[model samples]
Target: MADAVIVVALLLVAASATAAVAQREPARQALVLSVLGVVLAVLFTVLQAPDVGLSQLAVGSALTPLLIMLSVRKVRRQARAKDRAR
Candidate 1:
């Protein structure tokens, strides 16, 4: 029973990671990466490591995606400005 749940979590993490890698757009990749992070956190929790899970939740699922999205937005704005200046 527990093993099955663990397997499912592992599968979800693997699929999300593969999807993240396959994505071309930064925002899309970030979305998938966030999902991966959440799944990883769940897996950690299932494995009885709530501290690590909480850390992953805060850093990987939240901060990492936020940073990626902001970076993408900034880059896009810079690109638009460059185009405007041209």
Candidate 2:
């Protein structure tokens, strides 16, 4: 039972990682990366590292995605302003 849970978590993390890499758009990639982070956190917890998992959850699921999305928004905003100026 324990092995099975670990395997599932591993699979989830792998799939999400692949999806994140395969995505072309930054926004989509950010979303997939966030999901990957959550999966990794679960995997860590399954492996008996709750402290690591908690930190991963906070950094991976929240801060990373928020930063990526904010950067994307800023770049797009700048592009739009440039186009308007043109």
Candidate 3:
């Protein structure tokens, strides 16, 4: 059971990472990273490392997603401004 969970988690992470790498749009890539981080947090919890899982949840899942969203928003704004200037 544990092994299966681990394998599934690994696959999920790998797939997400691959998708992120393939994505050309910054916002889409960020979204993929955020999803991957949350999936990793869940995998940590499944491995019975509550402390590590919580830390991952807070830092990777929550904070990372927030930062990515902020960056994406800023980038979009800059792109719009540049377009207007042209």
Among these predictions, the greatest TM-score belongs to 2
Instruction: Please report how far candidate 1 places residue 26 from its true position, in Å.
Output: 0.5
Question: What C-alpha root-mean-square deviation, in Å, does candidate 3 show against the real structure?
Answer: 1.8
Residues 1-86 of candidate 3: C-alpha lDDT, one tens digit per residue = 88998999889888887987998987777778778778888888888887898898788767887888898899889999999999
Off by over 4 Å in 2: none
Off by over 4 Å in 1: none
Comparing 2 and 3 on TM-score, the stronger one: 2
Q: Rank the candidates by lDDT, best first.
A: 2, 1, 3
Q: Tell me, by lDDT, which candidate is best.
A: 2
lDDT tens digits, residue span 34-59, model 2: 99999999999999999999999999
Off by over 4 Å in 3: none
**Candidate 2, clashing residue pairs?**
none
Please give the TM-score that candidate 3 achieves against the real structure. 0.80
TM-score of 1: 0.96
What is the TM-score of candidate 2?
A: 0.98
Question: Any residue pairs clashing in model 3, and if so which?
Answer: none
Cα-lDDT of candidate 1: 0.94
